[model samples]
Target: MDEGANIPQYKLFINPFDLKELKRDIWIDDPIPAQLKVDGKRLEIDISYRGSHIRDFSKKSYQISFYKPNMFKGSKQIHLNAEYKDPSIIRNKLSFDFFSELGVLSPQSQHVLLTLNGKFEGVYLEIESVDQHFLKRRNLPTGSIFYAVDGDANFSLMSDLDKEIKKSLELGYERKFGPATEDFFLQEFIIKINTIPVPEFEKEIPKYVDVDKYLRWIAGIIFTANYDGFVHNYALYRNRETKLFEVIPWDYDATWGRDVNGKVMEANYVPIEGFNTLTARLLNVESFRRKYRNLLEDIMKKQFTLEFMIPRAEKLLQLIRPYVLQDPYKKQNIDQFDQELEVISNYIKERRNYLQRKLAKLN
Candidate 1:
C-alpha cells in the first residue's frame, strides 16, 4: 500500500525490553508503556494484547489506553483488531455500520495501516472503545457500561459454562463504567428478568431495559448471523435518564456470512427468534414478539437488502484493498479477500430470503 494512502497510518514505538516482556506473557492483561504516532501526533499510551483465542494468533490484536486527559477522537481507549481470520477484514466494520443504520448503538470503526518500530505490521481495524467517552461523544445520556466477556454473559440465572445455578448474578459481565454502588442495577435487572411471573414480566421488563433498542440490536445480530451475539459479544448500558439497560454490539468480526473461525456460515445459521434468556423472555410476551416481528419485516424490506448493503460492502473493500495487498499477515489470502464481496452479497440474498420465510411464521 502507498504510504500516502487515504487511510490512517498508526506507528507504535515500544521499548525493546517492554516489547519482549509483553510477548513473554501474551495471556497477561497488563499493559506496557508505549508511544503511538498517528496523524502526525505522538502520544504516550499503555498497550496490551487483547482478545482470548486470538491472543494465540501470530498477528495479535491490541488495546491502547491513553493517559489521563490525552485522548484520540474523544475516546480514552481504542482497539486495533488484527482481523486475521477475516479475509475481508471489513466484516467487523460492516456489521457495526449495519447496527448503527438499523438504529442500534454500535462502536465506530475504520480501516488503518499499523506499524511497529517502523516495520509494517498489517492492515488493522481501529475500533472506537465503547466506554464513558463513547457515550459522551454521542451526546447520549450518561450510562453505566458492562462488557459481556464470555458465554457466561448470557442473561440466564444458570451458567452457560457449568449449566448450574450461578453463584453471582453478574458472573459474565465486566463493568467498564459506573460507580461501585451502581453494580446492583445490573444484578437487580437480571434477577427481575429471571424471577418475574410471565404476566408481570411483560409489564416490568420495559422498565429495566429499553426493549425497542434491545430488539433492534437482536435484529442486527440475527441478520448479520452472529451466532455468539445472543449469549455474549455485546455490551449493556444502563441509561441514567430512563433507568433502562440498552444492548450494544461488540466483537462482530464473526458475522456477515462468517463464523468466529472465519468459516463459511450458512445464511440461516442464526434463527430469526435469536437465543438467550432475556430474548426468550421478551419474545414470550405477545406485545414484544409482535414488535420484533414488525421490526424484522421492516428491516427486510429496507435495510437488509442486496441493494442497500452491497454498495456499503464494496466501498469498504475498495478503501482497504491497497492496504490488504501490502499487509504481511493477509497478503497471502488475496484470492479469498478478492472474493469477499461476492461472499457477502450472496449472504445478504440468502439471509433475507430466510428471514422473510421465517417472519411469516413468527406469530
Candidate 2:
C-alpha cells in the first residue's frame, strides 16, 4: 500500500527483457538448457525441465519441471533472502522460509540481494528446483494443460481430494473469486495455481509419506486464509527405487490475502467465462468460520504448534532479519511483512474475534 521508492527496495531498474524479471508470464522460444539468466549472466541449471505454470522464454513450452533461478548460488540452489524492495520477489522470498517452518516440504532456499542498475533492489530466496518425476507418479500429464488455473475458485466447485478420498471434508473454504472485482491480476495469479486431473488410466497410486503431510500442510495454509497454495504450488517427489512420494510447496507470492480483498470493490469482468454476475464468488464467511475452528485445533496439534511452527518461525525471522532493511524503500516491504506477522503472531486472539464478527455480518 505504501508507494515510495527506498534504497533497499530499489537499487536498479530492470528491463522487462532483463533476466531478473522472471516472474511467470513470459514465454521461451527454444529448448536451451534450463538455466536462469540473472542480470544478463546465465547460470547453468541442474534441471532444464520447463515450468508448467509459466512459459519457457527459450522453448515456448510448458512442462511440469524445474528451471534454476538465474543468480549465483555456487554449489547449492537454495538460499535465504536478505534485503531489498521488489514486491514480486519480496513475497516468495518470505514464503521460502515460512513454509519450511510449517514443515511443508519444499526446495532448500537462500537469501539473495538483487540490485538493478547499481541500486539496492529487493531480496530473493533462491531455491533448488524439485524433480519432475513426482508429477508422473500422480498421473498428472507431462506437458501443461491448455489453460490451468493456480488455486482458482472455479476449481473449488469441482470435487476436491477430501471428498474423492472419503476424508472428512472441511466446509471452511473461501469463495472470494466470485463475480466482484474487475481487472483482477489474473496473469500474475497463474504463476501460483493450476488445475489438472489425475490420470484415469493410471490405477493404484503409490503411497508416499510426504503426500499426506503436504495435504495437511496445505489445509493449514488455507485454514489461516493463506491462498497462495494452489495445486501447482505443490509438487511431489518420488524415490526411484522405493517409489515413495513427497510434496513440496512453491511460490508464496500470492499467499495471505494476495488473491482476496474486502467485499467493496466493483467489477467490470466476471472471473469465469459463463458467470453473469460477480456475487457468486464472494468469500463465504460462515464456511470459513466453521472450517477455521477445526483447522485451528489441528494446527496446535501439528503444523503451527510450538514444537513445529515456532522454531521455524523464529528461524525464519532470524534468516530474514538481516535482509530486512531499515532503508526507505525496503522498509515498506518489511513493514508490510512485519504487520502481517504481527497480526498472525501477537494479535491473533483479538484479530480472530474481529474477523469472526466481520464474517458473521458479511455472510
Candidate 3:
C-alpha cells in the first residue's frame, strides 16, 4: 500500500526486549524508552499501551510521553488510539470536535499513520493529553485534573460497582495533575452535590461548577449517545482562578449509534435528562432545566442536523479511506468501514427525531 503523503506518519523505534516486555504486561502504566521519528525529526519518548479492554484487542492503543523540555506539537503527552472497534475510526475525533463546537473544552485530535520498528502498525487517532500542558496551550489558569477511571466516579455517595456506601469520595477517580491536597476539593464538591438540599444546592452549585459549561457537555454527550459518558469517560478540571469544576470529554469512540462493543444502539437509549447525581440535581432546579432545554433545542436547530453532520463525517471518512484500506488490522471490517457514513447519517436522523420528541419533558 502506498503511504499517503497527506497523512502524518509517526515511526516509533523501541528496543525489541522492551517491546516484548510491554506486550507481556499490557496493564502496566510504566512507559518504556523509545524514539519517535516524525517529519524528519527524531525525539526521545516513553511509550506504553493504553486503555482497559482495548488492550486485549489485536490492534492496541498507545500512550506517548515526551521527556521534559521536549514536546510534540506543544503537547507533552498524547494518546494514539487504534480505534479497533470503531469501523469509521473517526467517532472519537468527530465527538471531540463536536464538543468543542458546542462551547465545551475538548481535546484536539487528528489522524496519523503509525509504524512500529519500520513495520506499518495502522492508522491511529492522535489525541491531545488533558494535563497542565493542555491548560497552558489554551491560556487557562493552573488547576487540578482527575480522570474518571471507572463507573464509581459517578457523583454518588454509594458505589456504582456495588450498592454499598463508598469508603472514600475519591473512589473511581485518578488524579492526573495537581497536588494530593486537591483531592479534598473534589471530595467536598461531591459531598455537596449528593448531600445538600435542593434549595441551597441550586444557589450554591454555580459557585463550584461552571453551570453553562456542564450543560453544554451534557448536550454533547446526549447528542453523541455515549452511554458510558454519564458514569465515566471524562476528566474533571478545577480552575484555580475560578474555583469551579469543568468537564473534558474522553474515550468517545463508543458513540453515535454504537455501544462500547461496537454494536448498534437505539437512538433513544440515553434520555434527554442524562444520568449521574450531579446532573439529576442540577436539572431538578427549574432554571437549570430551562437552560438545558433551550440549549438542546438551539443545537438541534443549528448544529446537529443531517446537512451539517453528514458533510463533516463524509470529509473525515474520505481522508482516512486510503490509509484504512492499507491497514492490515482493518481488513476484516473493510465492508463495515465503507458503510459507516450511512450508519452515522441514519443515527443522526433517528437521534434528532428522538431528542425532539423528548425535549418537551425538560419543560
Candidate 4:
C-alpha cells in the first residue's frame, strides 16, 4: 500500500481443479483456501464469496481472512466489497471517509483492483473489517460485538417476535467476539434498549450508552442517507469502558443517494426524527434533541458541503475509472458509471438544501 496513493492492486491465484465447484457455491460453510499474490509477495488466505443480494450478482464480493497476519496492513480479515449496485463505486468510500473525518469509528476503505485466475473481477472497495482487530487497532475496549444479521435486528423491541428467545446470539445480535457466557447478559441489554420505559430510559440510558456519540452516528447515517444502516446495517459494540453500546456504520454501498436495492433515495427521505425507535426515544429527551440538532447543523456547515467532497469524489472516480471500464463482469457500462458520478454530485447538492430546510424546522 502506498502512503501517498494508498490504493493497491491484488492478484489472486486459485487452482483450476476447484474453480467450477467453488464458483458454483461460493457461500459454503467452509472458506476456500487460495494463494493471494500482491506486490510481489505471496500469502495464504481463506476467501469466500459473501453477501446476500450481492452473492447472486454477476460481480461477486469476497470475504478474505488471512491465515497469518501482515498479508494486508497487519490485519486478519478484510472485505473486498463489490460495489455492484453502485455505479459510481465510491459511495462507501465517500461515506466511510465522512465518518472517520467526523471523529467517529468507521472502517478504513480504499479502491483496489482484483483479479481471480488472471481474470479481472472489477474494481472493489476494500473495507476494513470491524472485528477484534478493528477494536485493538483503535484501542477501543474489548467487548461483545454484535452484527445486525437481519431486519429483525432493528433496535426496536417490536422486531423481536419471541419473548422466549433468551439467547442473545440467536436474537439477531450475532456475537462476533467476547465470551459465550455473555449471551444472557447481552439479551438483557437488548431488552433494555427495546422495552425500557421512556422515562426510565431517559434517566438511566447514559449509564449504559454514550448518548452524544450515538446521536452523532445517527447524524452521520442521515447525512449519508443510509436508510438500511438505521435499522439493520450496523454493528453494536458493548464498550467495556463506558459499559454502553456504541453504534458503528456498516454496508455503506447502499448509501449516498441510493438504497441497497439500487433505487434512488430522495433528498429528504429520512425524517429528522422518527427514523427508528432508538432515535425517536433519544430525540424525546430534550438534551439529546438539542445535541443532535447542533451536530447536524455543524456537519452541514463543516462537513457535508460539496466544496469539501467534490474534489475527493473526482479523485476517487479518477482512480477507479480504468478498472471499471476494464472489468468485463461489471453490471453497468462505462457511460452509466460516469453518469452515476454526476448523480452523486447532484445528490450532495440536493441533500444539503434539504437538510438546511429540515434543520430550520427543528425546535
Those runs of model 1 whose alpha carbons end farther than 4 Å from true positions after fitting are none
Compose the digit string of candidate 4's lDDT tens values, residues 181-224: 75766666656777778778788777766788788788888888
Candidate 3 lDDT over 252-351, as tens digits, reads 9999898889899899998989999999999999999999999999999888999888899999999988888889899668899999999999999999
Candidate 1 lDDT over residue span 249-345, tens digit each: 9999998898889999998899989989999999998899999999998998889889899999999999888878888998899999999999999
lDDT of 2: 0.36
lDDT of each: 0.91, 0.36, 0.92, 0.78
Q: In order, how many clashes per candidate?
A: 0, 34, 0, 1
Residue 158 of candidate 4: its Cα lDDT? 60
Best candidate (score: lDDT) = 3
Off by over 4 Å in 3: none
Please, what is the TM-score per model?
0.98, 0.44, 0.98, 0.92
- The whole-model C-alpha lDDT of candidate 3 against the native structure comes to 0.92
Task: Look at candidate 1 and tell me the lDDT of residue 218.
Answer: 93
**Model 3: per-residue Cα lDDT at residue 318:** 93
Q: Give each prediction's root-mean-square deviation over alpha carbons.
A: 1.1, 13.3, 1.1, 3.0
Give the per-residue lDDT of model 2 (tens digit) for 50-162.
44433322222122122444334333323223222223234454455556655655455445454534544444444554433223434443321111224232223333434
Worst 10 residues of 3 by lDDT: 67-76
